[model samples]
Target: MNDDGRRTTRMRDRAAGAAVMEQVVRLHAQAPPRSTLARALGARPIGEDTAPWFAGALGEREVGAVLDRLPEGWSVFHAIPVGTRPDASGAVSDVDHIVVGPAGVFVVNTKHHRGQRVWVGERAVLVAGQKQPYLRNSDLEASRVRGVLAQAGIAAPVTGVVALVGTKEVTVRQQPRRVLVLRAEQLVRWLTRRPAVLDAATIADVARLFDDPATWRPVDSSADTVERFAVIEREVRTAQLVRAGWMLAVALGAVAVALPVVSVLTR
Candidate 1:
């Protein structure tokens, strides 16, 4: 194949790959686009809660972009499906990113919690004062990657990486033994500094295994997209209704309290 053909093939392969979670994409698509003028005014669209989705997608893309830029030896896979096929509802489990290079194989789990303090422990993680299973979850993801590689006849060390994006502060109370946590910006430096673990031949072989669509399981495309959008729409509407219900309850309580005061005053 010529250069153009290779480029076209890469593009087609990327299109076929399910790198981002369907739910995340659906939530982002469900949100109305805000104009440049609105953004300048610091205004966001009302009624749709896209904050969580946007942050998550942004972090994934940010790290993916960085991985994409790695010098010649690196190969990065985004939105990899693992363990199961898409269910009846078209929902499938996904891993964020997997990086293979001379440095090693890393199962990179991204956490996009901008402006929120994150606390990490040996076996636990806490974000904004709420406990989360981030460390444990990352470990599981890495193990899954290891399992997949093993099935493909590749015996390689798979490292668990947790990349924190746009965090206000991160405190490591007890360093996790199973996962390496780093700020997204610090990722390139950290990876590049690692001792060479895989040779060019090994990198090429591993990359081929990961690049094959069959390695990831059942493919989910157009049909899954529609179902995911429907799910997100329902979630948004339900949230709006719940907010409205709380507002109604507050108004009724205020009326009840004011009625007693008015009666007392009239007397």
Candidate 2:
């Protein structure tokens, strides 16, 4: 029970990455065990099925880390499950983050495309020249959040934001019709700069409403989830380092061979 005498589930800081991390855990569990040789060679432990989810988890974590730095008077919720049932992808639809501040409410959708170029238009988002439904998804999430707030008798405006993570560059041809597109690093600054629309009392009310687990869908989460993901993340990073070392060794060997050949030819 919280101070308001309402029962609530314990929330973690990494709630933003919970959904994707759950997906990674499930997919990793289903994949066949790797052989000793494969493990030693640093072959990807996460299969193709789990890689995307892992990447997404990392993206959400990055965004969450930044959101954590928000000054006082701002309230943030991560991974708010909005869907009553899992979609065809076997994943529940969730808002990556919900932020309520003096500026009003924001529905954040996190997209992680490492080292990829992102172009945002008035109604479209292109990642590596391929169209993504980021804008549409952001709008939908905002709408859902609005509905939830309305049910609670809170009539604050909800803004949609698409936060791009790990992108090589983010180019906005034009802001989306109903959404703000920004790189993850720009999110906090953009948010803090927004003019205040809600006062102290309203902000506190909305924050309490969001803090109640009864306000969102029923989902199971615990500290264990974060710990489990941390283990997997460490393994993945170790494998990556091993692979890089092997590549470096191979490149040096090739250079060494080429140097000897050049010496003989010159002599």
Models, CA RMSD each: 9.5, 3.0
Clash counts for the predictions, in order: 2, 0
Q: How far is candidate 2 from the true structure (C-alpha RMSD, Å)?
A: 3.0
Please identify model 1 stretches exceeding 4 Å from their true place. 1-21, 24-50, 83-90, 221-267
Candidate 1 colliding pairs? 19-78, 19-79
* Global fold similarity of model 1 (TM-score): 0.68
Reference-based lDDT, residue 31, model 2: 86
| Candidate 2 residue runs with Cα over 4 Å from true position | 1-14
- Candidate 1 clashes: the total is 2
* lDDT (Cα, tens digit) per residue for candidate 2, span 1-267: 545555447333437788888888877878898899988899988988788989999999899999999999898888887888887768998889999999999999999999999998998899999999888889999999899889999879899999989999888899987999999999889999999999999998888888777788767655577778888899899999989999999999999989989999999
Query: Cα lDDT for residue 209, model 2?
Result: 83
Candidate with maximal TM-score: 2
| CA displacement after TM-score superposition, residue 33 of candidate 1 (Å) | 11
Question: Residue-wise lDDT of candidate 1 within 1-267, one digit each (tens)?
Answer: 333332112311442123443555654665677576654443444324445554555578778777766777788887777857665434566778888889889998989888999998887788998998888889999999888888888877899999998899999888799898878888888888899988888888889888876676545334464355445445545656666776788899999999999999999
Report, for every candidate in turn, its global Cα lDDT versus the true structure: 0.72, 0.87
Worst 10 residues of 2 by lDDT: 5-14
Q: Scored by Cα lDDT, where does model 1 land? A: 0.72
